[model samples]
Target: MLFVIHALDKPGALGARLAHYDAHKAFLSDTSALKVEIVMSGPLVADEASTMIGSLFVVEAADLATVERFNAADPFRAAGIWERIAITGFIRRQG
Candidate 1:
């Protein structure tokens, strides 16, 4: 089973994300069970000025419970950067 964790940052929570970025990266690097396939995270781009709204990532996990644990332990979660986190079971057909 593979799981995808989608996390959206709270409004005006860029600072929190940035603050925990290093720890988050470190945790990702250390985690062995979770395989990060595509990690493309940035601002939501809501205006001409392009203010950041949230983040997104595609990860592989053994099970939903494992993914939930991983998400719960994430530095972003600890730092209160995520307003909402959605986890979905994923099936890769092409890649």
Candidate 2:
């Protein structure tokens, strides 16, 4: 099944997020089950187009457990960048 992992960074954790970004990207590149389609994250901009405050990723996994495992191993989690993580099963439809 495919899953979408939505993560919100802890308050004032931008430094942590930046510090772990390389590791996080490496993890994503090395993972087998996780296929990152779109990664959109940065500080939250006062305007809609400002910096990112969190991140959103579209991933594919076999099950919720797998997704959970992936989340647990993410560098953001290790660096305390994410305060909240929300995962949901996804169905993609092309019109």
Candidate 3:
């Protein structure tokens, strides 16, 4: 199954995001993490601007539990950058 992860960072938390960016990237790019089969993943901007506010990811997993486990280990979570996160089953139809 596929899942969509949308995470919103806390207001005014850009500093934390920037501080842990490299680590977060490393975690997301790790072979173990990518085993879930990521289709697309990247930071979300505020409003067509360079300011990022969160992250979005489309990935394939066995179930929600598997995705949850992966999320629990993400460096971004460890850095406490995500204020709210939503995960749901996904059906992709376009690029």
Query: Model 2: runs farther than 4 Å from truth?
Result: 33-48
Could you tell me the lDDT of residue 11 within candidate 3? Answer: 93
TM-scores for every predicted model: 0.76, 0.80, 0.91
Q: Provide C-alpha RMSD values for all models, in order.
A: 3.0, 3.1, 1.5
Deviating ranges (above 4 Å) for candidate 3: 31-35
* Ordering by lDDT: 3, 2, 1
- Candidate 2: count the clashes: 7
Candidate 1 local distance difference test against the native: 0.69
Pairs with steric clashes in candidate 2: 42-52, 42-53, 43-51, 43-52, 43-53, 44-52, 44-53
lDDT of 3 by residue, 1-95 (tens): 98999999999989999999998887877636445777789999988778999999988888898888888888888888999999999887877
Better of 1 and 2 by lDDT: 2
Model 2 poorest ten-residue lDDT run: 37-46
Who wins the TM-score comparison? 3
Residue pairs in candidate 3 whose N, alpha carbon or C atoms collide under 3 angstroms: none
In order, candidate lDDTs are 0.69, 0.72, 0.87
Best by lDDT: 3
